[model samples]
Structure formats: structure tokens, C-alpha cells
Target: MAESEAILAAWDAYSDRHSDADGWPLDEVAYGWRMVQRDSETWRAFLPVRPGARQLLATAAFQLQHLSAGDIAPHWPSHLRDLNQALDRLEELRRGHAEVREARRTSGPVSQEKFIDSVAERNEEAWGYLDTWAAKGHVLLDVHAAAYKAPVRWVPTPAPTTVPARRAGRHV
Candidate 1:
């Protein structure tokens, strides 16, 4: 099997083995957020210096928001507003980055240094939003665990035989 398939299989087995008293499948939700948290941390190591890091972080944030709007919302209504706010900030950051890229492309080599400086400035701003997003995610995870009496700690699964290819220019 492909590595993703193997990972999914393992995740499925793990989820099957762990559920709340009401059969709410709390472990799957908590585990998904945990993975997102791990990836967010990994992304952070290089994100403050690399504007290219925005996409991965944005994707994770959006996914988490989607989860909150769906299955997780009913249980944690209070956190939904915070998650939405974080996602809105992230979207604003993304748009700001896009404008910088567009300006750089049109202005040509004469403004290369300026472009770099702009990216650096935006990177710091991006980090603030990402940090808050991750923090909110952690809070939601904690609330989920506490409400359902689910374990917050992740149980290790066997490694996939073949790792997936990393995206070009991405740290995580």
C-alpha cells in the first residue's frame, strides 16, 4: 500500500480502539488536532523567514476551522468564534503576501531588495497569526479532551514504510 493509505489504515484502527463513553470518537478529533499542532510547530521553525511557509499553515488552519464548524462545533460552541477570527486573520495575511508577490513581479529586478524586505516584514506578521491559531487549536483540543474525558496524549503508531514526498520549498 502507499504510505498515505497505510497511515490512514493505522489511524482508522487507532480511532476504532478509542472513543468516548457516548461513542463520540473523541480520539480521532483530538488526534487530528495533535497532528496539526505538530506540523504547525515544525512549520514555525522556518516560517518566520520563509513566506512560502504560508500555504501549509493556512491549509491546516482552514481544515481546523472546518472541523470546528462541523463535527466539533456542537460540543464546543464557544471556541468556534475564536477559530473563525484566527482564520480571518490568516486570510488577511495571505492576501497581504499575495499583494507583495504581485508587486515584486511587476516591479522587476530593480526592486528585489525591497521585495525581500517586504517579505521579511510580512513573515513576522504571519508568525503572530499562526501562533495564535495554533494556540486556539490547542485550547480547543484541551476542551475536547476535558469534556469527553479523552486522553490528550497521542499514542504512537508504527511508521509508514515509505514517507511521502515533501513539497518543494516547504519545511514541514
Candidate 2:
């Protein structure tokens, strides 16, 4: 299996093994914010940032402890241990992947694994950061929608008619 596929499967299996009652699943906001899947309410993946301070994610880093850095980490006592472990394992896997290694070798000047000095590479990095930021709730705005359907009733606003400037003293 591809490295990415393996990573994905590993994450899915790990997440599936956890539950709310068991204090698993970690932070709902810290998981996936780039995917809505078949359920929207379950995870606000594609929604705008909601109102509230995003305690866990203001930035992204390789290390979980460094994820928030100076900022106080959110209160996720029950799941912190597991989350840290998962991040560590994921990091290890990525570091050890042949593709990742090759990508790193291909990266130029300043060093980056996936982000080479190219438009597409930069775009991918930006998207990756956006996804990470969204997951961490480090967003300035977020909007929620119900099924994202067209309006049931269409009522376009009427256009304003141009009113000619009033003539002074009955001047045509």
C-alpha cells in the first residue's frame, strides 16, 4: 500500500478505536477540518471558523508539544496521551517513508520535505496548513450550512431605477 494510504488507514483505525464515553477521540476540533464526509454536524470540516478562542491550534509543528508552543494547550487530559502518541507515530512514519525522503532530497534551498520552491509545491503546503489550522480552530471565521442546497424560494432583489437629478427652479 502507498505510504499515504497506510497513514490514512492507520489514522482511521486509531480514531475508530476511540469513543467519547471512554474519553477518546481527543478534541473534535483537533481532528479533520478539511472533510465533511457524509456527515456535516459530526465534523465542521468545510465550515467557517466558529465563534470562540481556538485553544489547541494557532499553528502547526512537527511536535505535538510545539503545536501550540507558548500558548496554553487545551484541556484534553483524557486524550492528550493518545494524541501525542499518534502524532509521534505519524511523524516517524512520514520521516521514514521513501517518497517523503525523495521529496526532501528534491526540495531546494532552505529545506522542506513536501514544500519545494515551486508553485504547486507551495500550493500544497498552503492547503496543508489551512487544513491543519482549520482542524485546530485557528480560524478567524467559520460558517455552517444545512445541506448546502439552493433556496427553496427565489426572490431576487429589485434593481434600483436611475432617478434623473432634480432640475433647479423648473430647469428641464
Candidate 3:
């Protein structure tokens, strides 16, 4: 199976195994796991250039799934919409910053610009929405913890060839 499929399978297995630990029924845990995995996949796919916005989405996803499973009714769609708008703005700002950066890099001694400031503003707005949504329900991440961990994989290395020997017990 592919790596994503394997990861998902593992996650499913883990959730099933741990379903009893939670105070909910088996179906609730399964549903929550699926929701978390779906959002995780979405954020993993779209990781924006915005600094904290991506993390905000990740934390929101986890918290929403957890809350939903725990019988909490949250306005997840409205929250997601707010974050989505902020992400769009951040993306625009990020593109502008990149263009400015490239222009300065190609040219020489360009005047200082508000690239960092633009990024800060966009990122701050996105984070603000995230914070607001978290206040209404739950925040999966702590102040110091990052909301997401980018997916990574290991590749196998080729084995070295051995020299030929005339006999197993005796050398030529």
C-alpha cells in the first residue's frame, strides 16, 4: 500500500484500539478519528505561505473533531470560513512579499519595503480568527506548541555488493 494509505490504516487501527479509553461509544470515536484525519489531510495538502495560519487550521481541525466526538456542538463551518478568508488574505500578502523579495534580489540596493510588515499583518489577522474560534470551543495546541507537523517519509537505501569468493571456507 502507499504511504498515505498506510498512515491512514495505522491511524484507524490506533483509534479503534483506543476507542475504549474515551467515554464515548465506538461509533463516536470512529467518527471523530475520521473527521480529524480528513482535516489533517486538507491542511497537509494546502499549507499556505502564511506563518501561523497553517498552524491555526491544524489546531482547529483537531479541536473540532475532538469536541464533536465529545458531544459538543460547535460552529465549525463558520469558524472554518473565517480562517479560510484569513488564509486567502495571507496568501495574497505572501505572494506580494515574494515578488518584492525577488525584485530586490535581482536588482541592487533597493529601498526598504514593508514585506515583513505585510506578512506580519496577514499572519496576525489569521491567528486572531483562530484564537477567537478556540475561545468558543477548545484549542488543541498550547501557546508554545506548533499546530502541525509536516508529513515526512523514509526512503530505502541500496545495499552494497560483496566481492566474489572462490570458496566459503577458503580464500583464493
Candidate 4:
């Protein structure tokens, strides 16, 4: 199986093991995968973390920490442990991803330098996962930004008008 597939499966099983009595068992890996599968447009720059998703990850991570040594399978809990660490840094990655995506939405395709700068302003550990995602074909970056500098055009918005301007430039 592919590494990401294994990661996803381990996360699924890990999350499934921990759902509480008061509520339904949430499969957090599924949630994360669903979010990742969305179109780029759905990702707004600096989009706030989804509360439900965050809670699911936190709960699963908490449970994973208490695993017995026998439960520590190199392909499973160990995988979840790594995923938990990756999930821990997701906020930073999400922010950077959103920033670049939003900039692209508003200005045009995002530049690599701007994306790099945005990533650099945040924690490297966080950016590392994002870069991994990009490398794994889950995301992409502008090659121009990787090469020569370029300008991004602003998206046109309706011009706001003052009362005077609205009234044919006549004073009240």
C-alpha cells in the first residue's frame, strides 16, 4: 500500500477506537481526508480550523498516547503518532495554504516567493507537512514563483460610491 494510504488507514482505526459514550464515534482521518479532497476554492485563506475536525483529532491523539506497548504497531499506532504530530501542526499549514490560495484567488496565481515568505513567517515544522503534501501531488505551487518574480493582478470588485457620487455628483 502507498504510504499515504497506510497513514490514512492507521488514523482511521485510531480515531475509531476512541469515540465516547455521549456521542457518535467520529472518524477523524476520514474528516481530514475529506477536507483535503476539497477543491482549492473551498479553502479560504487563513480559514478558521473546523471545530469538529479539531476536536476529533485531539480526542484521537489523546487516546493514542495511552496505548500499551503491544498496541504500538509500527504500521498503526506509530503511524498515528506521526499523524498526530502532523495534525498538531496543521493550523500553521492551513494558514499558509489558505493565504496562498486566497492570494491566488484575489490576485491571480500565487508566486512561490510569496508562498515561501508566508511559510517562513510561520513555523518550519508546520510548513514541512505542507511541502510534503505538495510533493505528494495533493497540492501545487506556482513554478514562476519558484523561478522569476512576477506580478499578481488584483481581482476587480464593484467600486463603492459616496452619496454624492451616487446622486450624479450633486451635493445634498
Which of 2 and 4 is the better model by TM-score? 4
Clashing residue pairs in candidate 2 are 48-142, 48-143, 49-141, 49-142
* 99-157: candidate 1 lDDT, tens digit per residue: 88886678665376777556555554655555454444454444444435533346699
Writing each residue's lDDT as its tens digit, candidate 4 over 81-151 gives 45445555766566666777687789877777777556444533453443333233211122212212333
Q: Cα lDDT of all candidates, in order?
A: 0.52, 0.36, 0.49, 0.45
Per TM-score, the best of the predicted structures is 1
- After superposition on all CA atoms, how large is the RMSD of candidate 2? 16.8
Writing each residue's lDDT as its tens digit, candidate 2 over 1-172 gives 1333333455566566543656565666544431222123221332233222232222222133322322334533223333334334434433445454465567644355244324233223333433333343321121111112213335699887987789788965
> Which residue pairs of candidate 1 clash?
none
Model 3: residues >4 Å from true position, as ranges?
1-52, 55-59, 62-70, 113-172
lDDT by residue for model 3 (10-98), tens: 65676666566664446875665464554344333334323666676676666454442334324554656565665666466557667
What overall lDDT, based on C-alpha atoms, would model 4 receive against the true structure? 0.45
Q: Which candidate do you rate higher for lDDT, 1 or 4? A: 1
After superposition, the stretches of candidate 1 with alpha carbons farther than 4 Å from their true spots are 1-75, 139-172
Better of 3 and 4 by lDDT: 3
Q: lDDT at 99 for candidate 3?
A: 78
